[model samples]
Target: MNDHLVILIRSFSAFFILMIIGRILGKQTLSNMNFHEFVTAVILGAMAANFAFNEKIEVIHLLIALSVFTITSYVLAKLFLKFRSFKMWTEGTPTVLIEGGLILEDNLKKNNMTLDSLNQQLREKDIFNVEEVEYALLEINGKLSAQKKKELQAVTLKDLQLNAGNAPQFPIELVIDGQLLHGNLDSNHISESWMNSQLKARGKKLEDVFYAVKGSNGQLYVDDYKDNIQHPIDME
Candidate 1:
């Protein structure tokens, strides 16, 4: 078989197989995926991509591999639904961060959560006062669910009758996946030379950066592709 022809055939096959697999798997959108679902989707995509491009691997082998993994994932999902303990084990239970307007220091420390991070999440929800939050939970999906104090629930910005001096500014991404976002940089009046100097100071090149964003505080937060963490958490 011609190599190009073989590649084209494999690509088509992979595409159709993925469509079938997705239908079998049901609705799991990228926006609201849990950790296990994210892992499963990534692995399946990698496998399919490898199968499509790597001609050394036989077509039948790829089919068998996909079938095995698909069945395994399906079985595990069914198990997760059937047993409460199993579901909790696979997908962690919600963590309580605040109770009765008081921060739970012990719970925060155990989850490796900082006050700054908690405050940031709260700020995103337009909540400025921790005392106003009667209860706050860190959901399993990494979303913050907070309830305001009964007295504060009806209070509005109009009632305060105070000038909130400055509005919060969202962070702008200057670089993502080693690609420079030209518009973001231009809007911020950030020069490439300055960005290069910043990267050099950190002993990193542009290609080494996974994400680089200018924060509301006017600080350039650069995260590199290599996460040199001594202990990385993995549920599975």
Candidate 2:
């Protein structure tokens, strides 16, 4: 009958029931879940909490409530899988935020998202200026899909009118966390002697290195110590 005991019981029961339901519903239910799914989760949690720890509330009552929710979720998931229209109706389509560097104010207003929020999302993608984006979509899962302007995009060697004989090589790390990775060395067709020589150049021993990676270009990148450490030697 203790309030604290009831709260704890409800918390554990909610998690246990929701986890079971989620597993049966599939991973996509959590990953690409829509607004409806999110609401269902909250409702399930509230219902579970009402009975979980209350001494007057029996386990049978909690089981019945949990079962009903799980069954409803399962039915909806099945219906979504069976009907494309149902899926579309439940999970809204992506909304265009910007097209051709022009903000779609109508679509933004329809989604109840402001221009400031769009700009903030753009900044998160390393796009400080709105003019630099060619396309941006607000995904149903709340992810921003953005495309950089043509001039801002990376240019390949061919774009520069340059011809190369061979593809640039990348290095493979033979050791990490003081453990030797012979498989990586073999994949890169590099030998132990070559790795030792590369380490010697930096005056760093394999044991001293925190991590090391070899590039396809046969270049060795060694980090003997942690980064972001302000040491006098690092400043120099």
lDDT of each: 0.80, 0.75
Clashing pairs in 2: 6-53, 169-216, 169-217, 170-215, 170-216, 170-217, 171-214, 171-215, 171-216, 172-214
Judged by TM-score, which candidate is best? 2
Error of 2 at 131 (Å): 1.0
Give lDDT: candidate 1, residue 223.
88
Candidate 1 colliding pairs:
none
For model 1, how does the per-residue alpha-carbon lDDT over 1-236 read when each residue is reduced to its tens digit? 89899889888888899888877876643455676777778888998899888988887888888888888777777876556467778889788798767899999998889999999999998999788887888987788998776556675776366344433234677887687878768986889888889889988999999889877445689988789998999653
lDDT of 2 by residue, 83-108 (tens): 64576688877787887678999999
Counting only residues 3 or more apart in sequence or on different chains, how many pairs clash (N, Cα, C under 3 Å) in candidate 2?
10
